[model samples]
Target: MKQVTPFLMFEGKAEEAMTFYCETIPDSSVLDVTRYGSGEGGPEGTVKLARVSISGLEVMVYNSPVHHAFTFTPSVSLYVDCSTEAELNGIVEALAKDGKFLMPLDNYGFSRRFAWLNDRFGVSWQINLA
Candidate 1:
């Protein structure tokens, strides 16, 4: 297991988001899924949380009805290092669909190809080809 895991809070969309994530990543699987109504400690009749694993990376997603209290920020982002330009471009293009592009794909000083964008779910990602 990894030492540190990313926990994402969703607004009544934990199941949907987790399903989408699992489908997007190759060989990804849902390790465990516990619904609120099924658990004694969780809120009644709601999806409290879910655990999804993608390529051995564990991610937790929880449905928190309180949306106003928290907002997704660019301060934290996932950076994917690609070995080839084609791989980087594919990731960038896929993530950019129905998403906001912070910087168009271009060459940077450190990398031959780079791009930053926030996916449809509001999670930001930085794709770079070294």
Candidate 2:
């Protein structure tokens, strides 16, 4: 089957961010972590790319200091559909570290979920358990 995954770009915190994410999400794991210097077209010790999986969903994370002409905005976000309130809360809490919340975690008329700020790395996520 064809899969669509979210790709995240970090200035210089790809490794650290991936590690943190893996620790936060249950059954989440990181695949290959490639360094720049280890191959062509990257600086030494810097992460070139990494494949991470959370609940079987794959996400790509990369480190690119050269902004060139790209930037991250809140226009797009990843929505996580959780199975339980506890799982949803765990994700919200974990992603909230050093991150601000746009909306407080609470129960809405439609669903019980939390939507909030991007993490310290500026990645926005929506956690929902319906």
Candidate 3:
């Protein structure tokens, strides 16, 4: 295979999520974005497709035109290996705002500082201090 990338489907929050992730993570940015125009499948001005680079990983985000009963689950998640405690804390706090934590920031045997949470947009994430 040439490459594999993680895909995130958002009903209408793709752009917002991309912005939040890029701002929260150090050395991250939005690489590209395709917005839906008039007559497009998704609502006008909504994200048709977007590529966000978080640290170094490229993640794909899309705004789905059709509503679905399902959404992001904790079974799968974006994992982050933080190099500093400050970075870890900042990320955890930003992601946890208006979100629920599956495992709060604490030592979990494997890592000294670890946090697992579903962000406000329903995307799951695991933050760890390396």
Candidate 4:
């Protein structure tokens, strides 16, 4: 069977992002981190590969050896189905520290509450209460 997982690529903040996610999100964990050794072109000890689980969903995280021309955009976002208002609000506060919200958490005829924002790592997230 074929398996698919969401992959997150970072210029150099993969490790930090992975750690942050694990801390900020409930039931999240970071595991199997492999660092780049010297002369691998990436900064030594940077995250070359890692697996992160957020709310039991797998995510492949890695630091790029080369700088990309572009970063993440709001076009593609990770949608989270929060079970409670507290969960949704907690995630919103944690991710909003260094980020800006595209749409503040509010009822927009779609759901009771929703928030769209790009995190500090430039990754977009859409959290909702359902």
Q: Model 2: residues >4 Å from true position, as ranges? A: 1-3, 38-42, 68-70
lDDT tens readout by residue for model 3, 1-130: 9899999999888988999999999999999999999998888888899999999999999999999999989999999999999999999999999999999999999999999999999999999999
For the record, the alpha-carbon RMSD of candidate 1 to the native fold, in angstroms, is 3.1
Query: Model 3 off-target regions past 4 Å?
Result: none
Deviation in Å, model 3, residue 116 alpha carbon:
0.6
lDDT for residue 38 in candidate 3, whole number 0-100 = 98
Give lDDT tens digits, candidate 1, residues 1-130.
6388899888777777778767654567888877776445546776687788865778888888665676577788877777777767777877888889887898777776889888888888888886
Q: What's the lDDT of the predicted structure labeled candidate 4?
A: 0.91
Clashes in each model (backbone N, CA, C under 3 Å)?
0, 1, 0, 0
Off by over 4 Å in 4: none
Instruction: Give the per-residue lDDT digits (tens) of candidate 2, residues 1-130.
Output: 7877788988778899999888877898998887877555567877889999966789999888676566566678777788888888888888998897877787776675666568778777777786
- Each prediction's TM-score versus the true structure: 0.79, 0.83, 0.97, 0.94
Error of 4 at 124 (Å): 0.6
- Give lDDT: candidate 1, residue 33: 75
Q: Which candidate model has the greater TM-score, 1 or 3?
A: 3
Q: Between candidates 2 and 4, which one is better according to lDDT?
A: 4
Candidate 1 wrong stretches, greater than 4 Å: 38-46
Among these predictions, the greatest TM-score belongs to 3
Better of 1 and 3 by lDDT: 3
